[model samples]
Target: MGTRGLVAAMALMLCFGVDRVVSDASDHRYKAGDPVPLYANKVGPFHNPSETYRYYDLPFCSPEHVKEKSEALGEVLNGDRLVDAPYKLDFRVDIDSKLVCKKKLTKEDVSQFRTAVTKDYYFQMYYDDLPIWGFIGKVDREGKTDPSEFKYFLFKHINFDVLYNNDRVIEINAYTDPNALVDITEDQDIEVEFFYSVKWKETTTPFEKRMEKYSQTSSLPHHLEIHWFSIINSCVTVLLLTGFLATILMRVLKNDFVKYTHDEESAEDQEETGWKYIHGDVFRFPTNKSLFAACIGSGTQLFALTVFIFILALVGVFYPYNRGALFTALVVIYALTSGIAGYVATNFYCQLEGTNWVRNLLLTGCLFCGPLFLNFCFLNTVAIVYSSTAALPFGTILVILLIWTLVTSPLLVLGGIAGKNSNVEFQAPCRTTKYPREIPPLPWYRGTIPQMAMAGFLPFSAIYIELYYIFASVWGHKIYTIYSILFIVFIILLIVTAFITIALTYFQLAAEDHQWWWRALLCGGSTGLFIYGYCWYYYYARSDMSGFMQTSFFFGYMACICYGFFLMLGTVGFRAALFFVRHIYRSIKCE
Candidate 1:
């Protein structure tokens, strides 16, 4: 076979292997005496309102007993729990009591097992974050149980349990004194010890196997091929754009340098047009310098935090299965990186010749985070009202606030002071005139809005496919385990952002528009606008999520996330534009 054919065959084999593994995992069969271990999930939310209860697993049987019984019975009867925590088990009625015993119980057997029993049959079982309820025995109208019959039935079921063909059984032990029946109440704190045992019959049904296969196959790694394709496509586009821009920039700068230096005597006679005429005003302090500096500061911090989290996720520190790890890492890293925010904001503010260090530092800390917190509070309030598990509890909210106050706030202060103390003047190739240059009216296509629209779309396209998967993971049932792919796409996104911003800035400067500082930032940051548009499309067209609580929660948090993206990307674009502008201006003769 040719190389292409061989590659295709390998790909097909890989796909088949993945499917087989999923099928095997789901269709795993256990023998009649196989041990089915129960893992403890979180405690009941309604029961533990204060959230102070520390629950532990119930080790009902000793290791020696489990090992001895395994050998004696010639089967595995015990297993270790996957998670360690005490679980709540509530009982309900097993109405269809078709006995699977070989022999019927006699009157003497019933009398021997007679004991005190509960009037109500109610119990709750919790495993894998789902709760199941089953009853102990039948109850009469007077709310009383027949002790002798119940005991006899229970004993017969336990002793003569048969694994029928194509059937399985789960045996749970309700810890109670043999001489007395335990009464369960909703409000009462009764500790119930539960154990699970799986008994698989000799014969298996096709439906059972198919159902198992379906369950296993449902959690296939999400869109691996699509993600790879997107990453490759984005990288190619970025490279092409980067090469085009680099080639044009180098050639233009080289020609301009040669012309300006060699023709200096006749320079006055020639036209002073294009970026060559704007070296003086290009580096002049932009309007609203304080706000600009604050944005850069916050953006720098966000960029650092994003990079750190992605690195951690790539190294397997935070997997999708590990609940809350990603959010915990984000919060911790953001708090720790507050110094970056303060330092960048203060240094830029000082470079702009602004002495209001206090205001600059304060705005740097609050500009993005404050609005985010307020939005979170609103969404959290809605969640609390709906009693949704997604909402952070009051205690957790307080803890986050404390972390910000104690850790993040102090670091920002220190970073700001250091930045102010080490501040230096802005660098410019030519001296600014006493008055600002008059910027001519730009055509419709050369306007800021048009430039931003053009610059933003390409970057957004590069990451939109990956963004879809990320949205599904966050809002839908999909698990995002492919962080390695996400990291690559992230790098691609940055490269695209920088290259596109540079190209746009060059165009604007070539058009003799020196007001490129804010334009550069906005041009790159407009990708966030496209992202928000995709979010709207996903919510309406691609998702089935409805109701006020979910809607509010989704948009509320998304707004904050998009805002941060705006800051981070805008900073990246502006910095790239700055470097490009400086190099071009520095390359030519500037008198």
Candidate 2:
């Protein structure tokens, strides 16, 4: 492609807007003091079995509540040492002097205080700052009532008037109690309710003001910068490899061209015993059949997934900070993509190798099922550690497994069917002698494989420092200010993948060995593995992330994502190299 065409193509790619958050009108509301609120409620009379009266807002005296209240109130507590007595709130009642120890507390009276204090459930009920308690009228001063006899009564309920003014309540279900609410009593009725309002505070930082004010934010320029740097690097590498390989290929091509131009006597004699003529084998190339299949197959899957995700994101399916929905969608899509992976891998391999139908079926089944098993094992361990029953419930897991078996299985079968019907063909621009002219094969140190694989090191080095900063921002509890870095990293990944692929492909072809295509792809993309390994080493060496997380789960998850990234790298590199190779061969044939 020419410079102008490359520029235009980049322009097109940039014009593609697939931002998930921006696509949604609602997601635009991320202003810091944007009225998000929380709420809870409780209701009751005063008395209970063990204690005299209920006291709510007791935790306002506790450290956690102090911090919470401070944030809510927009104030900081500075006292190093402090002591404050908890308020004892109750509905006070004093019976006349004649009521001494003989009467049972019965069901009828509107005395001075309708609700009496009780220790049985003082802490049971809370609504924000209000504590609603159960109430019963007790007339006996000396405690001579029938053990359970108590009159139903009404007491003053506590209420919160302050925070309710500013915050908008999003949800209010049940009261939060330290002890779980197992079951409510039958004889007395209990009801809880909540209310909401919008609130805001002026707490913007200087940096935030600058970001909001400075420049017109667009991802295009960022993408262009990353892509330009990467493509340039890749082109340089490709040129070097291509130059070396072109020399090798020309050496072999020269021998064949000279031999074919020789006298008809030699040509006819060669043709008589030639496999190319007798067997009609006009196209013979030293291609690795399995590697070719893996490359294209993985590429197909990548293409489908990339298209699917970008489209979904463009359509507003993946909004930011909605962790639950985002994770759920990712998991579902990952499962669904298994069909694409299986179908592509199986059909492409089958076509490339002319493998038996039964073998293709087995391959598809094993590949899909093996990943599913691993995912399930990981999920099971997660469930055990977290004590969460909601982790892909048993029935859901079964259904998912069934869907994969039924839906993906047929897709693979249909792909294989399509492969069977389609022609399996290979082509080359020109064929050389059965035994071509020899050239001195370079030493292992000078081999193209080593050079192509080593290129991952430089790019990886450029980004490793940033990767550590990013990991710290993400996992080390450090503040990260640059989101623009994401665009930068993405561009780098593309550049590295392309450079490695083109360079490796050129060198392999120059060596007259198309069989190394897959190896080249793997070697180029496998840089991410080294990257992740380095990240892990850095993480272990620097941070303390083990307190709240199981290192096992963290490592396992990192491994999975890294492997996926590696596969993505391999797929991309292979496809680019194959495209260029085919283009060059076609151009030569036309000439």
Candidate 3:
């Protein structure tokens, strides 16, 4: 209870929870005298997930030769930096008190404790593969505090509460007693002792349900309400787009077709400036067809990936508490699904009479992976500089590379070969001209930028609210469990993107632009721009997240997400536009 002394122990609390993706590397079926180990992981300020450091870096009385336990791939990616601890614990056993170590605190040690307490750092550790977090210490400060009024206190002793069921370790909890606090106000070298106690309790709860309690009290809200407003907004978006497309197909396009087909108007008086009149150039395949095809292919693959993940998640393949289950699935599935991208891209390229099959295939393979690799390297460098847990080890990086090389590459090549040999061709109703007709000066709304903006707005509106929750889970240490609503929003986003893109394509063709291929893709993908804008806004609002490593991590992550959106939505829109253009031109007579 002294105001001037060296710190005995420091307790830290973490917002987000962690779980062993694989088991804790120990056989949980322990006999009566089995020794249970408590492994210490990284520590960081509770507010910043990317800002993390090794727990032993805090000058804790760790073992003389501290050794780190090997972690699974998923565990490392989730930022686990495990180090051996000196405390002794055993399964199905209890100890009243344990003296970890006694050491004389140097000036540097006292300063370290003061900084950690002021920053409100948290400690992470694993016992029986279950993660437990505690705040290192607490700071008592007066309102608008003067420097003289701030008092820093470190929790000297920690108590572990273990709940086991059916002889299997189930849940873990760590607590700091208020009476066991040491103040670190004095600047001189002081003596300190770090001690801990353990209590083992038998519980009836099943092993599978052990993580249930942590789920209820993480950074996210325990009680989830149905997001009715977002769902209703999505529904409205669907209706609005459906009505607009219906009107264009049933009314406007109908009138335009009827005029040139039936009315034998004079050449001077005929509407020479409409979609029906530009049939020859409408299907003329946009410039940079290979790049365009690559985008489409990549997007198709991403779409497939999304659906596959949703199905798997619905079947309960991914347990929420499994720290890296979702991530592992994403990497593996994305790699295995490379064939989808290769085949789709090859088909589109052949349809446009593309010559360089190899180049196209290469581009398709690099579509997402290229940018992702570059971004990862940049952020990883920053993480290494900060000695943060967010930095990936070389072994993990090699594993990812091997997955892509051994699995993803061969599948992609096989797919490309299949598509190339099939010899697909574009079946245009009207023959495209050797040269494109001159496009007349169009109104402002008919421009590509305007059309893309209009095309993206409806789809972006549908998912904007859902994105907030998703962002919170990724960056704000919140857990999102409403996959049903997420899938609904996803479906709605795709439909709206397609319909809106079709509408824009029709307008561009109506304005006599004739180049609908890339327009539709760009227009549909513009939703990514809107999402990226929201990313910027979120960064500004969360200004406490400063420093180079954390900033790069956030933006790099968001860039990949936005790029995927662009590909997925853009492909959806392009397909819809292609279908509309083919159907309309086939139905009408063009002389």
Best by lDDT: 3
Output the worst ten-in-a-row residue range by lDDT, candidate 1.
69-78
TM-score of each: 0.67, 0.51, 0.90
Q: After aligning candidate 2 to the native by TM-score, how far in Å is the CA of 13 from where it should be?
A: 24
TM-score of 2: 0.51
lDDT of 3 by residue, 241-280 (tens): 6787778667987787777666544363566557877877
| Model 2 Cα shift for residue 341 (angstroms) | 3.1
Over 126-234, each residue of candidate 1 has an lDDT whose tens digit, in order, gives 2222223333332223543654333221211211121233323222333322332223222233332223322223334443232232223223546456567767886
Misplaced by over 4 Å in model 3 are 1-20, 24-27, 217-223, 237-249, 257-261, 264-273
* TM-score of candidate 3 against the unseen true structure: 0.90
Error of 1 at 139 (Å): 30
Give candidate 2 regions above 4 Å deviation: 1-296, 311-316, 335-339, 361-372, 375-379, 382-392, 431-441, 446-452, 458-488, 512-514, 547-549, 587-591
Candidates 1 and 2: which is better by TM-score? Answer: 1
Q: Could you tell me which 10 consecutive residues in candidate 2 have the lowest summed lDDT?
A: 72-81
